[model samples]
Target: MQETLTRLTFPLSTTSAPCSEEEFVARFNQRPGKEARMGYDCPLCRNKEFVLRVENGFHRPYACRCVTIRQNLTRLRNRGLLELYERCTFENYHVTEEWQRGARDCALSFQKSPLDGWFFISGPSGCGKTHLCTAIASQLILSGHDVQIHRWVEWAAQAKAAVTDSGAYAALVQPLKDCEVLYLDDFLKVQHGTRPTAADIRLAFEVLDTRYNTPDKPVLLSSELSLRQIAALDEALAGRIAERSRNHAVQIGSAPGRNYRFK
Candidate 1:
């Protein structure tokens, strides 16, 4: 009777503690953002990943303009596509040569397409390959696709370094193989503009083959080498990329005029 009376008088709470802001934002990054979900990452107000301003001198329980950039930064950090992310857009790509106009048009078309095939662009240095690739990635991101820009030269080195450990290697390479869209920047590029090594071929094949086999996975490849050049080095790998991108490939000629840095 005494125990029953105590239980009745002071019942345990049924509800859990409210979720923390950090925890909530982490979850939010992984899904489509909640509408009207307003917060900030200012350490002055709180730990920062996003919001930069408080509205009307009130704490940031309300949305502000900086949230968009904040959200973009958070998203880019979450994805592997961090560099050139803030600025790359269709509007930013300059149209100089007739080929540039064509390239821009091709990029826009790829951005607007159903995204069933790969996008391959090859050009000499300074042809804006990375810029165009990033522009496409930015658009896909806004559409809520999980996109990553794999800086092939740098990312490949990282993949090579991680090979010392099996789990670490997989963790590094897994995203390249599985992301919704992958922008492979500077594909098969090497120091002194030399051809890729055998190790490079193996690594490239591992990631490209997996994506190649999956018909629905869309890949964007930008290389200093043309498809013909890549095919010369490794036809099997180049064949997969070429076959997938046959519908949307752009190859800029290696004219001194094609390189804008000369001017």
Candidate 2:
């Protein structure tokens, strides 16, 4: 895909023709048929203006940056995150404790270089874990990467409902493995002192193992359980999650004013 984009963009980069922003717009405002088909409002160029230029005596097309943003927005909307799109942003995430501030900074860093690895955020309910997770997801989306956010229990319920039909189950959970970035919000909400059932382990293993095996696909998790608690759920499943998320693990609770829900 990068190769394809490079091929398409090479011609535009080769020559210096547009003297100014106005000239660029005046000369190349023609939108591509493909862009029109996508139904975006000139996001690729970062501006509504697109360019079709005769550079080096060859006609070349360029997409607007707005198109890229719109594409990212579409990915979020497709994955049921569109509602959270506006509410979850770095600027909106409140930080009342030192740890919360640190966590927010870490999320910002992830936004800058998300390809580093996955993130595992553990905290009590209302500690703003979901807010932080969604903020990171939102930033990544704006950066033009595909992202999917799902509450773990809800996803599991949906997956389990398809148990009678093998094809339905596969269709339901396959995206958890395939998306470029996945945010498993409220992960593993099992009752305390009761170990996760075998069925739970099986489902968790399938999703976690697939994402862990694919190094490029980073998974973000926000859970109430600590890493130790998660390991207790199922050693094998938690091991898979831990191995990939080791460096990026963040614990944010027990500090003064850690919970942001009231704030």
Candidate 3:
């Protein structure tokens, strides 16, 4: 492995410059193994020594490429993919000491098992529920999981539009059904005539039903609605969600001097 990596170099002069002893010495000196191996003996490449076989092929008599490639792949999987996480910051997301500890614990637990569980974060506006939920989603994505975020009103509008168009409905449903993590922010923000429309209730139920039925894979939800409020929207859907969800909830207190908004 050492010899192969050391021997690897960029061609300096292309075919214009013929190999010379001085050039060879200079290039060899620049190589990684030259200085160390010149004085020490390599047991693996010594006379009568046995060579190991790798998945690619038998190791070279003095150098192995397989080990280098394996190391590179392992490093890439760990560090390279971590860079893909999408981070968002908001001025109102004040992480209290207690919440910070909880967040750390939550992150560690997710890193370990990464189970498909539901999370409901309910709080008045400007309480940082959305910020924290998105932070969690970003962390999960960095760990090589798929995550999707949607505003409650926007999602309702889209789903409503989809009801009249089969293709549109499928497009919306597939991601909601398949994503590793799905975040629904500002739940219950969609307006209806005095109560949630039958279609709205049905759409919500369909999503919850799919997740509830799939035991191996579950969905996560972040909503501004309290349990009681949610139950009021659709009792049957609420019951189904309660039955399958892991029952994680976060409630942030409204900050002082900040007005709360309800829809």
lDDT: the better of candidates 2 and 3: 2
Q: Write the per-residue lDDT of candidate 2 for residues 171-212, one digit (tens) a residue.
A: 988988898888888887766766556777688788888887
Q: For model 3, what is the alpha-carbon lDDT of residue 68?
A: 30
Span of ten consecutive residues with least summed lDDT in model 2: 31-40
* Model 1 TM-score, all chains together: 0.69
TM-score of each: 0.69, 0.74, 0.57
Judged by TM-score, which candidate is best?
2
Tell me which of candidates 1 and 2 scores higher on TM-score.
Answer: 2
Ranking by TM-score: 2, 1, 3
